[model samples]
Target chain A: MQPVQPLQSVTSAHTDRSLQLTLFIVSLVTASVLGLIVLFIFRETLPALSGPGMLRFVTDESWHPLENQFGMLPMLWGTLASTALAIFLATPLGIGAALFCRYFAPRPIVRPFRALITLLAGISSVVFGFWGLTVLVPLIARFEPPGASLLAASLILTIMILPTVALMSEAAINSVPESYSGGAAALGLSKGATIRQVILPAAKSGIFAAVILATARALGETMAVLMVSGNVVQTPGSLFDPIRTLTANIALEMAYATQFHRSTLFVSGLVLTFVIAALAIAAHRVEHRAGSHHAA
Target chain B: MQPDSSVSCAPGLMAAPSVAGSTLLTAQVHAKLSERLFVAAVWLAAALVAASFLWIVADIAFHGFAKLSWSFLTEAPRSSGRKGGISTILVSTLLILAVTVAVAVPLGVGVAVWLSEFSRRSSRTARVINIALDVLAGIPSIVFGLFGNAFFCVFLGLGFSIVSGGLTLACMALPILIRATESGLSAVPHDWRQGAAALGLSKAAALWHVLLPAAAPAITAGLLLGIGRAVAETAALVFTSGYVDRMPESLMDSGRSLAVHIYDLSMNVSGGDQAAYASALVLIGLLIVINAVAIQLSNRFMKSRIQPA
Candidate 1:
C-alpha cells in the first residue's frame, strides 16, 4: 500500500508539471506572435522612413506614388475627421440607449434588447459598406454630385460603431454598484435624476473606455470606409467632398504596390498601430484612476 | 433684470411670503420640465437604436435578398467576379474558418485555464499577459494583413496561400477566445470546485469532468464569435490569400474569400454591381443566421444548467 501511494503521488506531480508547461507554452506563443508582428511591420517600414523621415511622410500633402511623393496629411485629416464624426454621432445615442435600458426598460425586455445590440455588433463591416454604397451614397448624392463622399463615409461609420458603443456603455452601467442607486432612491430622487446624476457619473470611466475603443475601431476600419470615402488622396473640404483615410489607403494600394510604395504602406500600418496603442494606454489610465477612486 | 431684483427682494421679505411661494412653485416646475425632457431623450435614444438596426437590416435585405440563387451559392465566379458565382470564395472562407478554429481553441483554452485555475489575479505574469492581450485585441485587422504579408507570405515561404491566411486569422481570434473562456471559467461557482474535492476527486479529474462541462456553453459561444470574425475578415486575407478566384486544390494554393470577392467586384470590376449585391446578400444572410443560432444555443444551455442546479 505504501509503495502504491508513492507511485500515485509521483504520477500526479508529473501531470501537474506537464499541464503548467503546456499552458506556459501557449502563453509564450501568443506573446511571440504579438511581438513578431510588431517587429515585421517595423522592419519592412524602415526603407520608407530612411528616405522621407517621419515628419515629411505626415506633413506633405502630395501623395503621388508615381513621383516619389508620399505626404499623408490629407489622408490623416480624412481619418481623423471621419473617426471624430463617428464618435460624435455614436456617443449620445449610445449613452442614451444604455441609460434607457438601466432605468426605464422592464426586466423582461432588457435581455432581448441587449441581444439585439449584440446582433448589430456581429454584422460584418463589409455589409455596412455595401449598404453605404447602395443606400447611403445615393442619399448623399441628393445634395452632392457623387454620393461617395466623406459624409457618406462618416454616416456609415457612425452606424457601424453604434453597437460597440451601446453594448459597452450598457455593460458599464450595469457594473455600477446597486448601492449607489439605492442611496439616490433614499434621497427621494426620481429615477431619471438618479440615472443622470449618480449612475452615469459612476460609470464615467467605463463610458470613456467605450468611446476610446470605438474610436480605435472607427480609425482602423478599412473596407466600409474604403467603399464609401471615394478612394481619392485629397483633403476633404466639406462633408460633401470625398477623402481617403490611412486604413483605406493601405488596403487600396497593397495589391500592386512595389518597392517604396509597398514600404510606405507598411509605414502607414506602423503609424496606425502606434496611434491605437496610445489610445489603449490612455484608456488603461482612465480605468486605473477610476479603480483607485472606487477603492478609496 | 428688474424681475431678478424683485425675486431677490421677495426672498428677503417677511411681508410677501406669497411671492416666495410663487418662486418655489416656478422652481419646481422648471425641475419637472427638465426631468421630463431627459426622460423623453432616453426613450428617443432607445428607439433610435432599435430603428437604426432595423433600417440597416431592411436595407441590405431589400437590395441583396432577391439576387440569391442556387448557382450563386455553388459556381465559381466568372468575368472578374462580376458575372457568375461565389462558390469558390465560400469554400475558401470555410477553409480559413476551419484552420482558425483548430489552432485557436486549444491554445486559447489552455491559456484561460492557466489564468483562471492556476495563476492569481494579482500575479505579475498574469498582469503582463492580460496587458499583452489588451494590445492584441486593440490591433486593427489591416496590421494583421501586413504582418501576414511579411511574416507568412514572404518570410515563412507560404507565399499568399490559404495556410498563410489561416494562420494569421488564428492569431487574430486568440484574444477573443481566451477572454471568453476566462469569463466562463470565472462564472462557475466556487462551491462546485469544493464539491468535487469533497468527493475525493483529483484536481485534474475535477476540472475535466466538472468545470469544463460547466463552462462548455460559454466556450462554445466564444468559438462561434471567433468564427464570425474570421468569416467577416477581409484585409487580413487580402495579402495572405492572394485574392485568386479559384477553388483551392491544396493548403498552399491562394484563394479569395467572400469579403474580398465583394470588395474586388465593387471597387474594381466595372458594371459588376448586381453580382456584388448578390454576394453581399448571401454573406450577410449567412452571418445573421450564425449569430442567431449562437445566441439561441447559449441561452438554451444556460436555461438547462440553471434549472438542474
Candidate 2:
C-alpha cells in the first residue's frame, strides 16, 4: 500500500505541474498580446515623433497634415471637454438610480429593474450614436442650428454610460453590510439619514470607482460620439459648437492617410492609449480596494 | 408660589423632547420635506433609466422593423450601401465574431482556471494579471484599430483583412472573458473542490470534470457579451478590415461588418439613411436576441444544477 501511494502521488504531482505550466503559458500569451499592441502603436508613432517634434504635436492646434503640421490640441480639448460633460451629467443620475434600486425599489421589482439597466449597458454604442445622429442632433438643433454639437454628443454619451455607473454603484451599495443601516436606524435616524450618512459614506470608494470607469468609457467612446459631434476638427467655442474627438479624427481620415499623416494618426492613438491606461489603473486600484474591503 | 416655580422648571426639561413652538414645527417640516425630495429624486433617476431604454428601443423598432424583410436580410448591398440588403456585412460580422471567440475563450478560461483553481487568493502574480486585464479592458477600441493597423496590417502583412480585424477584436474581448470566467469559477463552492480531492482525483481532472461543467453557463454568458462587443465594434475594424462591401472569400480578404456598414451608409453615402436605419434595426435586433438567449441559457443551466441538489 505504501509503494502504491508513492506512485500515485508522483503521477498526481506530474499532472499538477503540467496544469500549472499550461495556465502559465496561456497567461503569458494574454499579457504579451497587450505588450504587442503597445509596442506596435508606439513603433508606428516613431515617424511622427521624429518629423514633428513631440512638443509641437501637443502644443500646435493646426492639424493640417498637408502643411506638414500635426497638432492634436484641438481634438484633445474636444475629447476632454465632452468627456467632462458626460461625467458631470451621468454621476448624479447613476448614483441616484443605483440607490433607488438598492434601497427604495420594492423587492419584487428590483430584479427587472437591474435587468433593464444591464440591457441598457449591452446596447451597442453605434446604436446610441445612430439615435444621437437622428434624434438627439435634431432636438439640439431646435435650440442651436446645425444640431450636431458637443452637447449633443455628451448627452448621448451620458445615456450610454449611465448603466455602467449605476451597476457599479449598485454593487458597491449592496456590499455595505445591512447591519450598518440597521444600526443607524436603531439610533433614531430616519431612513434617509441612515442611507446618506452610513451607507453612502461606506460605499464612497465604490462610487468613485464607478465614476472612473465611466470616465474611461466616455473618453474611449467612438461611434456614437462620432456620429453626433459633427466631425469638425476644431476647438469648440461653446457647448453647441461643433468639434471632433481624437477617435473621430482617426476614424474619419485613417482610410486615406499615408506616410507621415498615417503615423500622426498612430501618434494620436498612442496618446489615447496612455490617457486610458492612466484612468484604467486608477479605476483598478479603487475597485480592488473596494473588493478587498468587501471580502474582509 | 412653590407650585408655579416647580411647573415652570419642569416645562423647560419637557420641551427638549417635544416643543409645540414654531421652531420645532419648522424643523419637523424641514426633515419631512427633504426626505420626500430625496425619494422623489431617486424615483426620477430610475424613471430616467427606464425612459431612455424604452426610447432607444422604440425608435429603432419603429424605424427599422418595417424595413426588415427576407430580401433585406439576404440581398447584397448596392449603390454605396444605399439600397438592397446587408447579406455581406452580416456574414462578415459573423466571421469576425467566430474568430474572436475562438481565440479569446480558451485563453480567457485558462487564465481564469489558473487564478481560481490553482493560485492562492493573495498571490501577487494573480493580482498583476488582474490589473493587466483591467487596463486591457479599459483600452479604447480605436486604439485597437490603430494597433491592428500597425501590427497586423502593416507589419504582420495580414493587410486590411477579416483575419486582422478579428484578431484585434480578440484582444478587446480577452479581458471581458477572463473577468467573467474568473467570477464563474470562483462562484463554484469550495466543497466541490474538497469532495473531488477526497475522491483522490487529480487537480486537472477535478477542474475538467467538476468545476468547469458547473461554470459553463456563466462562461457562455460572458462569451455572448464578448460577441455582442465584436458585433457592435466599428472604429477598430475600420483600420484593420478594409471597407469591402462584398462578403469575404477568405480570411485574408477585407470585409465590412454590420456596424461599419451602418456607419458608412449613414455618414459617407448620400441618401442612404433608409438602409442605415434598416441595418441599425437588424443590429439591435441581433443584440436583443443574443442577450435574451444568453440569459435564458444561463438561468436554465443554473436551475438544472440546483434541482438535483
Candidate 3:
C-alpha cells in the first residue's frame, strides 16, 4: 500500500507540473497580444512619422493631409475639451446616482433601478451613436444656436458614461460597512450628515477612481460621439460650436486614409492608447486600493 | 419611481437622536442645499440614461418607420441607406452570437472548472492564469481587431467572415465567462459537494450536477454579460466580419452585423443622418432586449437558488 501511494503521488505531481505549464503559456500569449497591438500601431504609423515637417504634427492646427500639412493641435484640443466637458457633466450625476442607489433607495425599488443602470451600461456605443444622430441631434438643434456641436457631443458622452460611473460608485459605496453609518447615526447624526461626513469620505477614493474610469470611457468612446459632434477638425470657442474628438477622427478616417494620412491616424490611435492606458492604470490602482480598504 | 421616497428622508431634523434645534436647523439647511445639489446631479445622470432610451425610440420611430416595412427586415442591402433593411445583418448577428456562445461556453467552462476545482492551493500557474485573464480583460477592442486583421484576415486566410468575428469575440469574452464561472463554482457550498461525493458520486459528477446547479445563476449572469458585450461590439467586428452586406448563409460567408452596418452607413452615406439614427434605434432596441432578458433570467434564477437551509 505504501509503495503504491508513493507511485500515485508521483503521477499527481507530474500532472500538477503540466497544469502549471499550461497556465504560464496562456499568460505569455495574452501579454504578446498586447505587445503585438502596440507594435502594429507603431508600424502602421511609421510613414507619417517619417514624413516632412514631422515636428509640426503637434503644433500645426491646419490638418489638410492632402496638402501634406499634418498639424493636430486643434484636433488634440477638441478631444481634450470635449472629454473635459463630459467629465464635468457626468461626475456629480454619477456620484449622486451612486449615493442614491447605495444609501437612499428603498429595498423594494433598488433592484429594478440597479437593473436599469446595468442595462444602460451594457448598451452599445454604436446604438448610442445611432441614438445621438437621430434623437440627440434634433433635441440639441432645438436648444443650440448651431445644431450638432461640441455641447451635443459632450451631452451624448456624458449620458453614455453615467452608467459606468454610477455602477462603479455604487459598488464602492456598498462596500462601506453599515457599521460606519450606524455608528454615525447613533452618535446623533442625521442621515444626510452621516452619509456626507462618514460614508462619502470613506468612499472618496473609490468615487474618484470611478470618475477617472468614466473619463477614460468618454475619451475612448467612438461611434456616438462621431455621429453627433459634427466631425469638424477645428477647435470650439463656445460650447455650441462644432468639434471632433481624437477617437472620432481615427474611426472616421481609418478606412480611407493611406500613406502619411494613415500613419497620422495611427499616431492618434497611439496617443489614445497612451492616454487611456494611463487612465486605466490609475483607476485600476485606486480600485484595488479601495478593495483593500473595503476588506479591512 | 422609488426615488421620491428616498428623497423624503428629511436630512436635518432627524440627524441626531438628541435632536437639538440649532444643530438641527443648520443641518437642515445644509442638507437642503446638498440634497438639491445631489438631486440635480443624479437627475442629470438619470436623464441622460433615460434620454438614451428616448433617442433610440424617437430616432428609429421617426426614420426607421419611414423606411421599415416588413421588407426592411426581410430585404437585402442596397447602395442607399434609404432602401436597405438589416435582414442579413440581423441574421448574421444572431448566427455569430450562437457560434460565439457555443465556442466560448465550453472553453470558458473547462478552464474555469480546471482552475477552480483542480488547481493546487499554492500553484504559481493559477496566479499566472488569473493575471493573464486580468490583462486580457483590459485590452482594447482595436487590438483585437488588429489581431483578427493579421492572424485571421491575412495569415490564416479566413478572410473577413462571421466565423472570424465570432472567434475573435469569443476570445474577448472568454476571460469574462471563465472568471464568472470560477467565482460561481467557488461560491458553491462545500458541504454539498462533500455530500454528493459521500453518496458515491464521482468528483466530476458531483461538480457537474450538484455544485454547478447551485452556481448556474452566476455562470448564466456572466454569459449574458458576455453576450451583451459581443452584440454591442463594433471595432473588432468591423475587421473580422468584412463589410459585405450579404446575409451569412454559412458561417464562412462574409457579412456585417447590425453594428458594423450602422458604422458603415453613418460613415459612408453623405447625408445618412436619418438612416444612422434609425439604425441606432434598432441597435439600441436590440441591446435593451438583451439587457431586459438577461436581467429577468438573472433575477428569477438567483431568487430560486438562494439556499434557505
Candidate 4:
C-alpha cells in the first residue's frame, strides 16, 4: 500500500510538471510571434532601406513607381495630415462624451449610451468605408468635384476612433478616487468647477494615453482611408484635396508590386510599425504613471 | 436746483448697498448660466456620438435592406457582385474564422494561464510577455498583411490562401484574446485557489475543474471579440487570401472574405454599390449579434457570481 501511494504521488507530480512545461512552451512561442513579425518585415524592407535610392525614398515627393521614383513624403504627409485632423476632430467630442457619461448623464441612460459606443466600435472598418463611399462621398461631391478626399477619410476615421477615445477617457475618469470628489464637495466647489479643476487634472495623464492610443488606431486604419482618400500619391495643399496615406499606399499597390516596388511598400509598412511602436511606448509610460499615481 | 439735488442725494444714499448686492447676484447668475451651457454641450457631444452610430446603421439598412433576399444569402455572386448573392464569401469567412479561432484560442488561453496562474505578476518573464503582447497589439493590420505575405505566403510556400490569411489574423487577434482572458483569470478569487489546495487536489485538476469554468464566460467573450475583429478584417486578408470569389474547397484554396468582398465590390467594380451595401448589412449584422452575445454572457456571469452559494 505504501509503495503504491508513493508511485501514485510520483505519477501525479510528473503529470503536473509536464503540463506546466507544455504551457510554458506554448507561451514562449506566442511571445516570439511579435519578434518573428518584426524580423520578417524588417528583412523584406532591407533592400529599399539600404539601396542607393534610400535618400530619395524619403526626400523626393514624386512616387512614380515605374520610373523608379519612390518618394514617400507625400504619402507620409497624407498619413500625418489625416491622422492629425481626425484626432483634432475626435478628441473634443470623445472627451466631452466621456465627461457626460461620468458626471452629467442620468443613471438610466448611461448603460445604453455605453452600449451604443461599443456597437459603434464593433462595426467593421470596411462597412464604414462603404458607407463613406456611397453616402458621405456623394454628400461631399455635391460641393466638390471628387468626393473622395482627405476630408472624407478624416471624417470616417473620426467616427471610427471616437468610441475608443470616449471609452478610455471614461475609464480614466472613473479611476479617479472617490475622495477627491468628496473633498471638492466638502469645500463647496461647484460641480463644474470641481470637474474642471480636480478631476480633469488627476485624470490628465490617462486621457493623454487614451488620445495617443486612438492616434495609433487612426494611423493604422487602411481600408476605410484607402476607399475614401482618392489613392492619389501626391501631397495635398488643402483639406478638400485627394491624398494617399502610407497605409492606403501599401494596401493599394501590394498585389501587383514586384521587386523594388514591393520592397518599397514593405518599407512603408516598416515605417508605420516604428511610428506605432513609439506611440505605444508613450501611451504605456503615461498609463503606468497614472496607475502609480492612483496606487500612491 | 435744491429740489433736484435732494432727490439725487436720496437715491444715491439708497443705491450704495444695492449696487454691491446687484453685482453679487449677476456673478451667481453668470456661474449658473455657464454651468448650464457646459452641461448642454456635453449632452450635445454624447448625442452626436450616438446619433452618428444610428445614422450609419440606418443608412446601410436603408440602402441594403431592400436588396436582401433568401437568394442573396444562398446563391453565388454574379457579375462582380452587381447581382446574385454572397454565399461563397460567407462560407470562406466562416472557414477562415474557424481556423483563426482554432489557432488563437488555445495559444491565447495558454499564455493567459501562464501569466495569471504560474508566474508572479512582478516577475521579469511575465513583464516581457506583457510588453510583447502590448507591442503586438499596437502593430497595424496592414503591417500584419505585409508580414503574412512575406512569411506565410512566400517563405512558407502557403501562397495566397485562406490558411495564410487565417494564420495572419490569428497573430493579429492573439494579443487582445490573451489580455482579456488573463484579466478574467486574475479576477478569480485568491481564496478559491487556497481552497483547492486545501482539498489536496492537483493544480491541473483544480484549474481544469474550477478556475477554467469560472473564467469561461470571459474566455468566451474574448473569443467572440477575436472573431468579430477577424471577420471585419479586409486589409490583412486582401493580400494573403488572393480575392478569389469562388467557393473555397479547402484551407489551401484562395478565397475572398465578406469584408474583402465588400471592399472589392465598392472600390474595384463599378455598379456594384447595391451589392456592397447588402454585404455590409450582412457583415454588420454578424458583428452586432456577436457583441450582443458577449454582453449577455458577461451579464449572466456577473449575476451568477454575485449570487450567494
lDDT of 1 by residue, B67-110 (tens): 77898888888889776788888898888778889899998998
- Model 2 lDDT per residue over A1-296, tens place: 43348788789979899989999889878977878888988888787788537677767767887887778889988999999999998999999999999889999988788878887887888889988888889999998989999999899989999998999999899889888888986676677867888999999998999999899889888889999999887888999999899888888888889987888888888888888889889987887898788678
Fnat of candidate 1 is 0.65
Q: TM-score for every candidate vs. truth?
A: 0.93, 0.93, 0.83, 0.95
* Docking quality band of candidate 3, CAPRI definitions: acceptable
Interface RMSD score of each model? 2.8, 2.8, 3.8, 3.8
The runs of at least 3 residues in candidate 4 whose Cα sits more than 4 Å from the true structure, single-residue gaps closed, are A1-4, B1-23, B302-309
- Scored by CA lDDT, what does every candidate get? 0.84, 0.85, 0.74, 0.89
lDDT, residue A76, model 2: 88
- N/CA/C clash count, model 2: 0
TM-scores, chain A, per candidate: 0.94, 0.93, 0.93, 0.96
The deviation in Å at residue A18 for candidate 1 is 1.4
Going through the candidates in the order shown, the clash numbers are: 0, 0, 5, 0
Give the CAPRI rating of model 1.
Answer: medium
What is the DockQ for all candidates, taken in turn? 0.58, 0.61, 0.33, 0.60
Candidate 4 chain A least-lDDT 10 residues: A1-10
**On residues B1-309, what C-alpha lDDT tens digit does candidate 3 reach at each position?**
322323334543343344354565665577678867755565565556555555555656677666556776787767655566777878899887887898888777767877787776469867656655655665556656656665666567888888888888887888888877887787776778778756655565666678778878878878988998898998778778778777677988887888888887876777766556556667776777877876776667656655637
Share of true Cα-Cα contacts across chains kept by each model: 0.65, 0.72, 0.29, 0.82
**lDDT of model number 3:** 0.74
lDDT of 3 at B259: 86
lDDT, candidate 4, A152-267, per-residue tens: 99999999999989999999999999999999887766788788889999999999999999999999999999989898888888888999999998998888899889999998
- Tens-digit lDDT track for model 4 on B24-128? 555566767877887888889998998889999999999889899899999999988888999999999998888899999999999999899988889998898
Q: Sort by TM-score, best first: what order?
A: 4, 2, 1, 3
